[model samples]
Target: MEITILVFGQIKEITGIAAWQISGIKSTEELAAKLVMQFPELALMKYAMAVNKILIQTDTELNENDTVALLPPFSGG
Candidate 1:
C-alpha cells in the first residue's frame, strides 16, 4: 500500500519537502522506524502523526490511501 505523508514545521525543513510518499507501510510504529532509518535527521526530533486527519498513537493500523501528517510542536505566544 502507498501512503502520503505531510511534513510540517522543522520536519519539513529537514526533509526539504512538504509531502512525501512511501510504500509497504503497515502500522504507525513501522512507519516511524522506517522514517528514522531513511531520514536519520528525524531520529533527533519529536513529532506527532495524524492519519487521515485523525491523530494517532504508536502501533496504529493504517490503510491504503490514508494520508499521514507528521507535525512538529507548535510554537507561538
Candidate 2:
C-alpha cells in the first residue's frame, strides 16, 4: 500500500523535492488526484507518468513499494 514517487524536470520544481513516499494510494488515477491535491500547481502542468520505469498510457494499478515517476514535457537536441 506504499508507493515511492519520483519527480523530474518542472515537476520536481513544483514539488520542491525529487522523491517522496506515499501510502494508501491504489492506482495511478488516485495518485494523480492526490498529487494535485498536495501540489495544486501540478494541475496546471502537463506531464507523463511511469510505473516502475514503464510509461503508462492509462490508469495503472500500483503495488507496495512500487516506484512512480512524474515526468514533465522535455525537449532534446
Q: List the residue pairs that clash in candidate 1.
A: none
What tens digits encode model 1's per-residue C-alpha lDDT throughout 1-77? 99999999999888888987888998888998998898899999998889998888657988898899999998887
Give the per-residue lDDT of model 2 (tens digit) for 1-77: 78999999999988999999999999999999999999999999999899999999999999999999989888877
Residue 11 deviation, candidate 1, in Å? 0.2
Cα-lDDT of candidate 2: 0.94
Residue 57 of model 2 has an lDDT of 96
- Candidate 2: stretches off by over 4 Å: none
- Residue pairs with colliding backbones in model 2 are none
- Scored by lDDT, the top model is 2
